[model samples]
Target: ENNKHVNDTENTLKRQKTNKKGGPKRDEVWEYFIVDDEKNDRHYPATYYHCEKKWQKGKLRTLKAHLSNECLQCPENISKFWRDKLSTELTNYTRKQKTIIQLPLKQYQITQHFSSDKPLPLAITERIDRSLLKAW
Candidate 1:
């Protein structure tokens, strides 16, 4: 019985840790818009406008866009602050993504001749190139 109690306590702690790992803390944007419980679908995140009371389905960035670009519910001063904050965040994100995508790998250098045991056919090579480009 004592061993079972100790096991139960350990199991509860493990469950709590797993639960905490599943969800990150809510973003600050949640203060402006609230999840629309009535209209929310499990597959999508939904929020309602304060002024219009309309339900919108989108990710956090989409909500930020709405506040920064289209929403008229907030007062001029608050709206301007949010717009500037979101704009700065977007600019930083764009710069970071650009650097990550543009930076070339230093470890792998191209050679004049194919280093593989057998060179891939031209058709297969072109297909792979196209697929990678499309993926990016």
Candidate 2:
């Protein structure tokens, strides 16, 4: 049981909030703003991307420039809560003609767990992308 618990904990993705949004400092990516969209061109305004890192020595290191852009490791993605939220958001996004989001690997697995026993309806099922599903 202890080993199982440890395994569960190890599988989690650690997100350490290094800085706050809307602060005086002007060097970070926290949030993104959707400006305009067309068939190909889509503009995103000012946004922030806070750095995250795996735990070590009881602290976190900034992983912004060091890590590659494609890396998105989040523990919430693997939890059941994320799965339900993503599923719901996908449904809503579909109804609104919006696109489904892409979350990181661990986070994506958590997002899938939200569907436990009850699967989603058929309407939104068709638009779902398998790659995106595997991404989170």
Highest-scoring model, lDDT: 1
Tens-digit per-residue lDDT, 33-70, candidate 1: 44443335432345533464444564677766666667
lDDT of 2 by residue, 1-136 (tens): 6874564344321211322345455232222111111233221232122223322221111222222232354333333444464467568874446787987645466557587678778766755766568888
Q: Name the regions of candidate 1 deviating beyond 4 angstroms.
A: 1-22, 37-45, 94-136
Q: How large is the C-alpha RMSD of every model relative to the true structure? A: 16.7, 26.8
Clashing pairs in 1: none
Q: What is the TM-score of each candidate against the true structure?
A: 0.42, 0.19
Error of 1 at 1 (Å): 56
